[model samples]
Target: MKEAENIFLNLINQHKGIIHKISKMYMKDAEEQRDLFQEIVLQLWKAYPTFKGNSKFTTWMYRVCLNTALIYFKKDNRKVDKAPLDENIDIMDVNENEGKEEKLAYLYTAVQELNAIEKALIFLFLENQSHRDIAENLGISEVNARVKLNRTKEKLQFIIKKNGYEF
Candidate 1:
């Protein structure tokens, strides 16, 4: 049991960036993001035993985290008020350019306007996942992933532009 726990903790620490990204993509508030993050970890732990290692850990992680976020959002019906970026969010990039940070902030804000599946599409796209991978993760067809991703990008751009921010 201890060995399993240790391995799980190590894997989580190694791939925590994935969790951070998923939580932030789903939630706008720092506190809410943290809560969602915890919930994802809990879900992951519970489902860990079912991992048969037939696929990459990350693939499994993404499915669990995304499902958790979608369900969490529905269960809570959360509506986040537009608040300034919290210093606590792990948004600090290696580039550290203020302009880039501001741009990213606007992007995140615009992303909040997206539906859950749309947000997942954008998130997977930004992560450089191919349509096939996105489809596999989302349990959809590859062609559907590509079509939805293209449409989601168009919608996200419209949302940002509508919010008075230029690309």
Candidate 2:
């Protein structure tokens, strides 16, 4: 138990940023973000032993984090309504010179509009996973991964345009 706890703690310390990033991307409110973070941690701990180290730890961690967030969103049926257009048009203002927060917000809005499979695809794409790796991780064909990624990018572009953003 002590050994397992140590391993889990180490894994958490190493991969915690993924949890934070996913939570921030998916959850709008502070309370929901905290809940999602905790849930990701719990799910990671639960799935630890099955981790065979066949992939990089961070790669495996991304899979687990994405899976947990996707499942949580599904199970809770928590739908995020797109904010009314005039209510806060400036919220989507993205500055290329700025840091990740602004860019991430735009990406998050685009991501939120995607369906679950597309969300997973975009998540892996943004993480810089190759089509082959994404296919292995997602259990799909490499051709399918490539095709879906292209379509997902187009969908994201459409979402950005619909939201009045030029990106």
TM-scores across all candidates?
Answer: 0.86, 0.80
Candidate 2 — worst ten consecutive residues by lDDT sum? 83-92
Off by over 4 Å in 2: 78-96
Q: Residue-wise lDDT of candidate 1 within 1-167, one digit each (tens)?
A: 99999999999999999889888888889999999999999999999999999999988988898899989987897663332221211212324475887888888888898778877887787777889999999999998888777777777766676798774
lDDT of 2 at 6: 99
CA lDDT, every prediction?
0.82, 0.76
Residue ranges of candidate 1 with Cα displaced over 4 Å: 78-98
> Model 2: which residue pairs collide?
none
- Looking at model 1, residue 151 earns an lDDT score of 72
